[model samples]
Target chain A: MNTAAALSIGVFLFTYALIISERVHRTVAALFGAAVIVALKVVPWERLPEYLDLGTLLLLISMMIIVNIAKESGLFEYLAIKTAKLAKGSPMRVLILFSVVTAVVSSVLDNVTTVLLLTPMLLYITRLMGVNPVPYLLAEIFASNIGGTATLIGDPPNIMIASAAKLSFLEFLSNMGPIAAVDLVLTVGIIYLAYRGSITVSEGERRGIEAAIENLDENEVIRDRELFRKSVAVILGVIAFFFIHDRLELPPAVVAMAGASVLLIWSGVEPTEVLEKVEWTAIFFFAGLFIIVGALVETGVIDGVAQWLLGYVSDTGQALVIVTWFSAVASAIVDNIPLTAAMIPLIKAMGSSMNVYPLWWALSLGACLGGNGTAIGASANVVVIGIADREGIRITFLDFLKVGAVIMVLTVAAGMGILWLRYVGV
Target chain B: MSIFRSLIDRKFRSIAGDRYDEIVKRYREFLLLPEEFVLPEVESILIPLDRFSGDFHGVLDVLEAYRGAKVRLVYLLDAQTFRLIEETLGEEEAQKLLQVERERGKRLVEALKESLEGFGLEVQAEERFGDKGDDVIEMASEYDLLVISRSFGSEVTKTSPISPVVLKVVQHVLVPVIVY
Candidate 1:
């Protein structure tokens, strides 16, 4: 490209890089970049609305509303307490409980919420048993990300991807659900190796903890009875609607918006409060990023990059390896949502006839697995970190990346192999 | 302070002090960068602070969004105010204050997060208690960003709006302090 176009994209990258390095406020960064692109007329200011991605926004808003109400009802604490009781005192038991609890919570709610609620409890529970909460915390974080993969609602990236790609809940279930289930089992296995020493249990402490957990049940945490009852039904109904949205020919966003509205009307949750929970900064960031990416697309920069990569990895055999590996690494550095979106059209263009469906599955695996690559790789990682800080256990970037690298590689390999066999007759 | 307590405090202060320098550095960097930014693949964050001056969640909400992509937040508390609030307001009243704080904090964070994430950033929130604001500065750099609330300073001088301790934090630590 010419110097001016190159200069604009470079400016965008530098700004994004600064953000990646956390040298700025994300919303401000996004807005700045967007304003520049608009003002400079790189992609023309008129094209902004086309990039809104409203489907993604509506789903996120609805889910945020749903989760906010659920938290109000003390749904997360209830799950955590119940999981601890089920696990008793054995470290292995703790891992099992944490994995299950985190996964389930993340699936219906979001990974961030799951970690926010469970990580502290994990820290407190582990410390109470005289063990380091780090390893368990990591496992819970990984498990939450994995578990959230089973359904579209589990993670925001996935939700955005599903909505943007027009994939149904069943599509997510069919492709991601199996991978997530298998990934969890493998994760639980590896964690068994990671924390073998801490999993041991004494009979007395185990029962004592279990009995204590039973006493302070969710009812104790949730004081509002009617609100609680209303939320339970809404959460359940939303999930059911998501699952059946495809069969009914309904877009997931429609279902989400409807669910959010019902929640507002039935539960007496103020619309203002619900709107407040929408995470506007995140929304603006997405809009700005879209414009930035659109700026690249408009200038044919992404197309150029896509063409170069497309030529190198055209063989089905080579393409699979490259896509999986690149996805894992690329997702680790860049937020996977944008990265995945940029790639979809490119992958289809290059291997239009090679059954890109499996490749899509590979991207899913890579994006999800890659998220474990760093503390910033996925929402699940951030959520648990937030909770861990509350308990005084500090997990640095290097500290988390060290373990995250291993999990990403192992799960991506395992997920790729599973899909290969099913689709390609490995 | 007893000898054992003194040793723990000294070690904690060292950690927190170091953390404070890093926190200031991050905030400075955050303020300086161009507005169109994308954070690193953030997963877990570690913030070590001594004590906060109350308005804990409000302060946390601002610093927390800058926490790389996909956040796991860790807050180091002073345990002093943790107890004070528990005692003065008693467990029930303190919890009520905390509950209100959590709700408001959630709203604000959600707003901030949406704005930030809209630019491709993810955030996770966390907290802990130790002694005071002085105690967490040492460990501030260990996190993506360190935030010390004014609650830490409030313990020593209840009459003052912003205590000398908080001023020291702003002056000394390299991190950011959302003082109210």
Candidate 2:
């Protein structure tokens, strides 16, 4: 390898090591790596913007602001309490309702935010019902990953893929949505069966929980009715805009940004407060990651990897399975964001030889669903586990792996099958 | 000579500004304080209850020893719990949950007060919202004796260690403590 190629590869691997070992914060590690590459003249400083996908960054920021504002209205808490009340103290029903809501919400919002808002309330509800929250928390973790797979904007990897491929929101939904729904059902079912004994409540305990839940006033939880109304309206309008944004020749980021701006103005919330809620670390992490990955592309390293990957496969179908399983396992071990970041360019390089459209779905499915493989696999998994730990309900890595790995394998297999049938034909 | 001294003082003040004043205030407040050695007779007793774990009944006999003493029952809604909630949701939601927990704490204090009143001791109840150990320590000086449960800050089993809050209160409070 040339000096530039070797240096970029070394910096990338070293940065990845730091992130995986968690010796340094991932953002700091990524930025450090990016800085080393630029400082060494491996990737020029001025060309940094060429690699940073503003669409993905903008979409992430806009959605975070919107969710932050909406949360202030107490909408998520209200929904959670309402869902628990709807369950009427049945443990199984609560599990189902919570899992479904988690999935549906995750498909629209980011998984981390979805889990952050829901997990605490889930813990509270389960504690009240006198049921073990482990099963419910596990279900939500899996469901969030599965649900995030259904839409382009849902998962970070999918957002990166959509922005790169110029895929529309409807395109992602139509392709990944069905399989995500199927996986959600299957995962929740397995969880319920596996933990049925622990989640089950006695008759008297059920009656007591029912009485307690009755006293929980969901309406009282809504902090601002006017803001809530405005938020719901803007969010719905944003989603609707996402549906036809392609027809209007608008990028997903534009739609999301417009919605965030309107909500910021309409809700009369302090912009600084709402902006502070944005995940700036993730944004900067993405920026640095793009530059690092861009170094690979600039050094022709991605082309070499693509050629090596193509040497094994004859057609897109075989490549689909390879990409799906490979991405899944790789993402299970590493953060899916960086994995997707590196894979996007590789897929583009491979697009030169074959119809690589199906490969996007494969990458999306594999990367998004693969996050369920371990407790540390996805941001959502880490977040929920952190919250659970703080609440004195420990979910160890192995404990999560035993369940998350199985669900991940099942979901990825289903996604591969759906992609095969849809694109590769029976 | 006085004018020269004033000029020097003005220069020092300009250089140090608020930090100098803060240090002076702290020095006056802490370093110059008189030492207190006398222990007051047990005329008023304070009992800080943990909503989930403290054993109020275990201290009844201790209270009965000071039969006619005034007992003040305080239930503090744990700010730590709401802080955890805030980490997930925002501050506004955590505040709302704190309000709910405060109401619950009030009811608990009232029920404890009613039961203590039945024992013929003059009891006053107050609900607070803050760190349990810190709040108790702050209020400990006002009362002659403090009766706290072994599991003051956390839910515990027989094998569990004494709560950190209990340890802190024991080490820091000036009053005599009865850990039930």
Candidate 3:
């Protein structure tokens, strides 16, 4: 290899190491790496825009602001607790509800936040009801990973895929979304069968759970008469605009940012506060990541990787199978967002070599599914951890990793099978 | 048993990026007004709606003497004078301001109720809505003490120095007003 190539790889490796070690905040590390590459002139400023994709960043920000408002409504906790309350303290029933809700919410918003919001409530519920929460939390994380696969905005991997593939919102719904839905049902089924024995709750357990719910303070902001109506209108409009904006030649970025702006002004949020809540770190991570990935692409590294991987699999069908398994494995340790972003160009370059665009679907399925492999596999995991810690529940990384492995296996296998039968087998 | 104990004893930041410890420290001082007081028989206690914090159980522990007081929980909502929001703005902007006011009102009310149990005031919360001063003055004749909450709406903007309606309620009410 040449001096420049080795230097690029070295910088990337150092950044990844710092990220994994948690020695520095992720945003700072990402910004620092991006800045170094720019300062070193590894890639000139002119090539920067090619590396950056504003769609994913804008989508993330738009969703975060919307979700922040949604959270204030107390709907997440209220629903979870209300559902669990109906279970009458059955540990197994609670586990099922936790997983299902975690997945549903994770598919729409980030899974990390869903788990974070639910975990403490889970812990508190479990503690009060005299039951263990470990099983339920593990299941919740798994469902979150599986559920995140259903849409373009559901998880980072899907976003990376959407941006890289230039696929529209409808494309995902027509293809991998249904596949992910099936995989999720299977995951829930498998967990229920395995944990059925532990679910049996005595009457005493039922009463304990009832008492806990009775203790909840339900003075919800959902009662905000005017804001509630406006917030709902603004959110529904954002959703509608996301799907139809393509026809108007309005990019998803403009629609989302516009929706958020309207919601802020119309619903009475100060501009500064909304802007402050925007996670510039995640945005910077994308900006820097794009530049780094773009640099690699410019250097012909991506072409090399894509061509080799494509060459290794004779038919496009085989490549699909490989990418699915690849995503599941890689996602267990590293976050799927950056990983998926890193792979997009490579997939695009080599996608035509395949029998079809099957590899694109494979990559999407794998990256999203891989998030279930470990607690840190996606952004949602961190959110869950943070929320749980606030409520005094400690879900260790290793604890999540253990269940992550079981569900990751089931999902990867299911995805590969789906790819072969749908795109390859025929 | 050890795990349960640890969970109950746990301490962490409350709001994202807020110095919850400092807030707690400030609230502890506010709750201990008058410095010293003799024990009173358990009967009734007016939990001044706004002067409370997320430490209700601890507060209840201190006032254990009032074991069975039927607690009247009052939430003071600042009816938010609309001069700043209403001043010199287009009709669209004015409507938007009203939207924010209602959301701010609900968020504050919910947050207050959620954190109330920490004080262990066996409580019933009543939100006396409308502009804070006039509404609170009218209701002061009925309650033992008025709890003062930190202003729920935006800080009195430089554009409108209306001094907030909560202040007016504190001034006019014959009953003692608790402000945090």
Candidate 4:
């Protein structure tokens, strides 16, 4: 490699190290790296925006606005409380309901938002039910990542992949949906097996807690009934339109933005307030990370890495397995968003020899599922940990990895098996 | 007949005519209704919201007993605490932390309001920034009664079933206090 390629690798590794070490805010670390690259002329200043994926950025922002309105209306909380009531204070039932709802919600909304909205309410329910919230919270983190794999808007990595590959929303759902569906069920089963002992309550205690919660009128949390109704209608419409966006020749970002606008006008919420609620840290992080990844691409570092890795696998089947495990392990070690961003171009560089479509699926499955391996593996995991810390609940890294690593391995293995059978020979 | 009967026959018939039976029927129906379904004689209730402690259910039970009473829930945001957090974390971080507390307060008030509504009470939520105990005690005079929770805080003791704020409220408020 040349001097520029070596320097690029050094910059990338240092920035990544800072992010992983948690010594500085991940966003700040990424932005620092982006600044360094631009100052060093690794990537030209004027071409910075070209490196940033505006489609993914716009998609994230629009969806955040839409979901923020739903949250402000207390729709998600209302749904969660309803789910809890359905569980009737049984700890096992509570875990099931929460994981299912969180997974389902993450399929449409972003994982971090799904986890954020659910974590507080889950903690409260666990308190009322006399159970520890950590296990349920961990289950939710896993569910969110798994569920996110099923949809384009569910996770940052999926959005990046969709944006980069020019794949439609329907394409992602069609290819990734089946395995994600199976993985979600397997995830719930594994979590139940692992946490069932701690989540148990006596029959009488369960009934008492159930009776207490039955009195909570979920309707009471609705600040605006009219706004809630309007948001639901708009969201339904958005989902319906998402299915046909490709046929209609529209981008998913446009569809989401249109839905957001409709909600804004219908709900009469202040645009500024809704915007403030958006996770701008995530947005900036994506923007800066894209530029750094672009620098790696410009210097042929990704190509070199891709070519070197390809030297080990001769056939498509071997490539599929290798890519899945590599992505999974790498994603578990680092933030999946950055890992996926850096790998997308690398995968595209290998597009000439294999069916790029299956590789995309493999990467999507690995990166998304791998997030459950460690606390820092996914944004959702980090956010959930932060919420727990604020409540004086300390979830140690090893504590998460002990359970998460198992689920990650199981789901990633399940994903590889499914891909092998469906795309390759058994 | 007595003079009253004679007066009723002559004066009351002229005013009532044939509509008197319908009016009397309506009056009887009103009296036959359950007491809880009837509107309360009292005007409104004042609740001193201590951020840290309250049996939400018990408070609602008290409100249930006064069916149809208007409720005013006062949540005092302590400015001193906000300033302290600001000093330590700077403006943006402080605001974020305060925003979380504000959300918690709002949610608590809303939950109470909903429970009160379930009991047919008209509810109003008020947020003030000051010493919580002093504000609640001062504001208790505006309403007919003060209904506060007996559970003092997240951490409770038998010596203090009621929070210090509730204790101050009980000592100084002009209205009768109902400690749930």
Which candidate comes out best when scored by DockQ? 3
- Interface C-alpha RMSD per candidate, 1 decimal: 17.3, 22.7, 10.7, 30.4
Model 3 agreement with the true structure over A317-362: per-residue lDDT tens digits: 6667677787778877776766776778877778567654777788
Which sections of candidate 4 miss by over 4 Å? A1-7, A389-394, B1-180
TM-score of 3: 0.68
Evaluate residue B71 in candidate 4 and report its C-alpha lDDT on the 0 to 100 scale. 85
Report residue A24 deviation for candidate 2 (angstroms): 1.2
Residue A286 C-alpha lDDT in model 3: 78
Which one wins by lDDT: 2 or 4?
2
TM-score of chain A of 2: 0.97
Query: Which candidate would rank higher by TM-score, 2 or 4?
Result: 2
Consecutive 10-residue window with the lowest summed lDDT within model 2 chain B: B26-35
TM-score of chain B of each: 0.42, 0.67, 0.45, 0.68
Which regions of candidate 3 deviate over 4 angstroms?
A1-7, A85-90, A203-223, A247-249, A382-399, B1-180
RMSD of each: 19.6, 17.8, 14.7, 20.9
Between the candidate structures 1 and 3, which one is better when assessed by DockQ?
A: 3
In model 2, which runs have C-alpha deviations exceeding 4 angstroms? B1-180
Q: Over the stretch A1-426, how does candidate 4's per-residue lDDT look in tens digits?
A: 877777778889998999877678778999999888988998888988889999999999999899878766668768877887999989988888888888889999888667766776687678877787888988899989998999988888899999999899888888888888889789889878877789899999888878877767788777689888998999999999989999999889999999999999988999999998787878999998998899988899988887887787677788888779989999887778888988899889887666767888889999999988987677677777766765777777788889999999999999889888888976
DockQ per candidate: 0.02, 0.02, 0.03, 0.02
Q: What is candidate 4's local distance difference test score?
A: 0.80
